[model samples]
Structures are given as structure tokens and as C-alpha cells.
Target: MLVKIEGIVIRARSFGESNQVVQVYSEHLGKLSFVARGAKKTRSRFSALTQPFTIANFLCFSSGNGLPTLNQADLVHSHQAIRQDLLRTSYGAYWLDLVDHLFEEKEPNPGLYRFLKTAFDWLEQEKDPDILTRMVECKMMAAGGYRPILHACAQCGSEERRPVTFSIYQGGFLCETCKHTDSHAIPLSDATIRILPVLVNLPIDRLGEITIKEETKQQLERVIRSFLMEHVDIRLKSWDILEQMRKVWAASDDSTST
Candidate 1:
């Protein structure tokens, strides 16, 4: 059957000497892989449209069983700004990898598809990539049915406690009284605790209004990373590379400061 799909290219790779395989997360069709014949050549029309992070409308023939064959593509947004910068690309790649890993093929998730499209648009606009990334992570976790409890205690649902810590194993905030349930819960500052829900619930369009302290951002990163590792447990090559790049940059900064 011939269909028109609005999708964001999540991943693309060489299929043969001349063909390219592109995986896209569509608004109505979820994830679908398409074979673009002769897309490897510079003159091929599919070459640019098949690039990762591009949002496009695709015409394809679907057999409802095997890979679809891409017939034509109309560019919506190339998101070239994201591709031109290394840091942005790293963060964008991580988001794509996370989405690809969390979602199953052919399952429609319109909310996630819209969130991803908004994220790429914001990234291309030069919004703080870290903040955008954190928002995406929160949204992805929620979409995956593993949203951490940030509004109240995960163990007992108490909001009257004075101090709280995040527990990866328990899957959210633990009130002071319930903190004993997890001996290794990570203590968070008031700021970090306050921002957790905001990150999770805030609308993507209002991202510019959100400002986070460096310390709080660091703590948020740790908590989110631990939560994802404990629950999702998927290893992403792009995330690994981003970590390495951060370490190298930190080392360079330390050397220059000394």
C-alpha cells in the first residue's frame, strides 16, 4: 500500500553499495525503516532527506511485513544547524538513540513523535541543549511508563517530610521517614528537588523560561542517569561518546585553570 508519512529520521545507514536504509519515527506509524535505492550517491535526491535529524514527508510502499521502499521525500526541516555543531549533534544523537531504543517498531506514539520534533526544532534554534536534552529524557521516561515520582514520596506518598532524597531502585523521591527503605538514596538539594517535576511536566515551548543553576543541573543529571540505568538499562553508543567528550573537555579546562 502506498502511504504518506510525516516523520523524523532517527537513524540512517548504508544498505548496499548504492542504497541507504533509513529509520524514521512517524507521527502516525511509529518507527519504520525505508530502503532508498541509490541514496548513497551524491546526486541522489534521497541523500539529503535520509540524513538523521531531518523531518520530512515520505512516500513509500508498505507490504505490512518487510522493509518499506521509499519512493519520494519532501523536506520539511533539515535541522542543519544541529548537524553542524559537535555538542548539539552529540546531544541530539543521544536523544535519537534513546527514542529508538525505548520505542518498538510500527507502534504509533504521536506524543513522542511531536515531542521529538519540537526538541529538534529547539535544538536547531540554539536553545540550551542540556536543558532541552533533560526535558526530552523526562518525556521519554514518561512515555515509556517509567516516570519517576517527583511530586511526593515514592515509598509512602508523603509530602509532609522535611527532607527527601531520590532513590533509583524505589523509582522516585523518598521522604526523610521513608529514606531508610533505600540505604543508597542520593540526597538532593531543595533546588534540584523543586526542578525535577518542572523538567518532567513543563511544556517544551516554555523551555526558554526555565533557568537552572549549575549545581542543580549536575544533580539532576546524576539522578536522571541513575533512574534510566536502573529502569531502562539500555546502553547507547552516543551517550558513551558524549560522556567521553565531557571528560576530555573537563580535563582541558582543569589544565588551563591550573
Candidate 2:
């Protein structure tokens, strides 16, 4: 069966010598795999189209069961800016890894497809990639149906204004009284709780207008990390790579400043 799909190349790995296996999140097909027969060749037709962060339209010969064989690919958008920087590359890889690992195949979710496309666009242009990365993580969790309950206590459902606690396992913010229910709950500031919803609910383009403080960013980052790790329960190899890269960048910065 022949099929056409409009999607972004989330991942690309060499198959053998001249072939490449690509994972794409398409508007029509949520997550699909394609094998580009000669993608590794220097002058291959699909060479440019079969790359991470490249959005394209693909023509494939589908077996209707497993991996599809790529016949042709036409480029739609090349996120070149993201590829130019190491930090951006790592964050892009993390996004691709999360979608590839968590999203189920053949499930058509146009909302998520659009969200991811917007995220890549933002990643390519946005100066504050760290804050953008955190925002995307929150959006991903909500899109995946694990939306954190930030408005009220996750355990007791209290909406009164008071200090709250964050419970990754219990799944949201808990009021002071309900904090005892989750012994592991960590204190969450009123500001952090307020901005949690804003970060997730705000439109992507407007993200530039909002400024996130370093301390607040750290809090959100911790919450996001714990929430994803505890709830999804999956080990992300990309996270390790990002952490290592951060250390290297920090050391390089320190040396330059001295």
C-alpha cells in the first residue's frame, strides 16, 4: 500500500550502510517508522529530508504491519537554527526522545502534532531554551493526559489560599493540612503554584513576553523532573546526555570568565 504523510523527523539512525531508519510524528499518523533505502548516500534524494528537526512530506510503500519503505520525501521546514547550537540540539533530542518513547503508534492526535511542531519552531527561534524546554515538558505532560492538578490540593481538594506542597506521587499541589497525606511532599511557593498553570496554558508565541526568574525556573525544573520520572517511570537516556552537556558548558563558561 502506498501512503503519503506530512510529518517532522523526530529521529534518524543509520540502518546498515546506506539506509536510514526515521521516526516521524505525522499529522495523519501519530508516530510512524520509515526506512529510507539510500538516505546515507551523499547525493541521495531523501538525504536532506531524512534528518532530525526536518519537517517533510513522505511517500512510502507501506507493508501495513511493520516499518514502511521510503520512496520519496519533500522538505517542508528545515529547523536549521536548532541544529547550529549544541544546547538546542540536546533539547531537541529530548523532545524527540519523549515523543518517541511515550506516544503510542497509529494514534492520530493532531493537537499533539501541532504542539510539537510549534515547539520545534519556538526552539529554533527562542533565546531562552531552558525555560522553553520546561514549558514544553509541562505541556507534554498535560497533552499526554497526566495534567498536574495545580489549582487545588491533589489529596484533599482544598481551594483556600494558603501555602501548598508538591506531591509528585500524589500528583499535584497539596494544601498545608493535606501535606501530611504525602510525607514526601515538598514545600511549593505561592508564586510557583500560580505560574505552573500559566506556563502550561499560555500560547507558545507569547512565551517571549513572560520572563522566568532563575529561582522559579529551578523550582519548575525540579517539579517537572520529579513528576515525569515518578509518574511515567521511564529512564530517559537523553536526560543524562543533557546533564553532561550542561556540566561541560558550565565548566567552559567558568574558565572563560576567569
Candidate 3:
């Protein structure tokens, strides 16, 4: 079957000496894996289109059993700014990895596709990548059906709780009354708690309108990481690299401060 679709490149790997195998998360087809012939060659037409994070329109022939063969590709957005910057690339790579793991092949999710495209646009425009990443993580969790309950206590469903903790195992916040339900629950600051739902549902376009304190952002990161670890089974290579880069950046900052 011949199909034309708009998609973002999620994964790309060398197949043969010259061909490349690319996995794209399409706006209409969800995720599709296709082989781009001679894409590894410097002069190949598909070379740039097969790159990670590139959003493009693709024409392909699917056999219904094995991988599809990419016939032609036209660039919509190369996201060159993101590709050139290390920090943006790390966040972008993690988002792609998360999407690749969260959805099944050929399952159309137009909502996710739109969200991802917007995220890339913002990242390229120099939005705070850390905040953007956190927002995307929360949104992705919600899309994957692993949304953490923050509106009320996950245990008793009460809205009048004074102090609450985040429970990864229980899948949400626990009121002070129910804190004993999970001894492992992480204590959350009022600020962090207040921002959780906002991050989960905030429109990407309005991300610049709000500012998050550094301390609260760190707390939210830990909570989101723990929640994802408890709920999602996928491992991300970009996350490890991003952590190492963060450590190096911290060391550099410390040196500059001293």
C-alpha cells in the first residue's frame, strides 16, 4: 500500500552499507518503521530526512508484513537549532525515546503528534528546556495513561488535605492522613504540589507566561522521575547522557561561583 504521511523521525539506524532504517511517529499512522535506501550516503536525498527529530512528509510503500520502503521525503521542519544545540538535543532525544517506547506501531495518535511538534518548535525557539522537558514528561505520562493524581489524595480522594506526599507506587499524591499508606512516598513542597497539575495540562504556547522556582523544579523532577520509573518500563539512553551533561554543567557552575 502506498501512503503519504507527516511524521517526526523518532529513531534512525544504519541498515546496510548505505541504507538506513528509520522509525517515524506519524501524525496519522502513529509509528512506522521504513528503510530509506542509500540514506547513509552523503548525497542521498533521504539523508537529512532520516535524521532524528526531523519532521517531514514521507511517501512510502508498505508491504503489510515487514518494513516499509521509503520512496520520497520532503522536509517540513528540520529543527536545525535543536540539532545544533547539546542541551536542546538531549531533551529532544529523551522526548523521542519516550514517545517511541510509549506507543505501539501503526497506532495513530494525532494529539501526541501535535504536542511533539509544538514541543520541538518551542525548544528551537529557546524556551527553557528543563521546564519544557518537565511539561512534556507530565503530558506524555498522561497520554500513556500513567497520569499521577494531583487534584486530590490518591488514597482517600479528599481535597482538603493540608500536607501531601507523592507516592509512586500508589500512582499519586497521598494526604497527610494517608501518608502511612506508603512509607516510601516522597514529601512534596506546597509549590511543587501546586505546579504538578499545571505542568500536566498547561498549553505549550503559554509555557513562557509562567515561571517555576529552581527548587520547585528540582523537586518536581525527582517526583516525575520516580513516578516514571515505577510506572514506565522503558530505558532511555538520552536520559543517562543528559544526567552526565548536567553533572558537568553543575561542576562548571560551581567553579565559576568560586
Candidate achieving the largest lDDT? 1
Worst 10 residues of 2 by lDDT: 156-165
Q: Estimated TM-score per prediction?
A: 0.94, 0.94, 0.95
Clashes of 1: 0
Task: Name the candidate, 1 or 2, with the larger TM-score value.
Answer: 1
Candidate 3, residues 1-258: lDDT per residue as tens digits? 999999999888989899989999999989889999999999999998988899999999988877889999999999988889877788899899898888888888798789989999999998888898888888888888989888888999998885479998998999989999999999989898888888888888899898998999999999998899789966788899888877887798999999
Give the CA lDDT, 0 to 100, for residue 139 in model 3.
84
Report lDDT per candidate: 0.89, 0.85, 0.89
Instruction: Kindly list the per-residue Cα lDDT of model 2 for residues 184-221, writing each as its tens digit.
Output: 88777767887877887888778778887888888888
Q: How much RMSD separates candidate 2 from the native structure?
A: 1.6
> Candidate 2, overall lDDT?
0.85
Q: Write candidate 1's Cα lDDT for 1-258 as tens digits.
A: 998999999888889899988999999999889899999999999999988899999999989887889999999999998889777888889998998999898888898889889989999998887788889999999998989988778998877775479999989999889999999999999999888898999989899898898888999999998899899998889999888777876798999999
TM value for model 3: 0.95
Model 2 reaches what TM-score against the true structure?
0.94
In model 1, what lDDT does residue 204 have?
A: 95
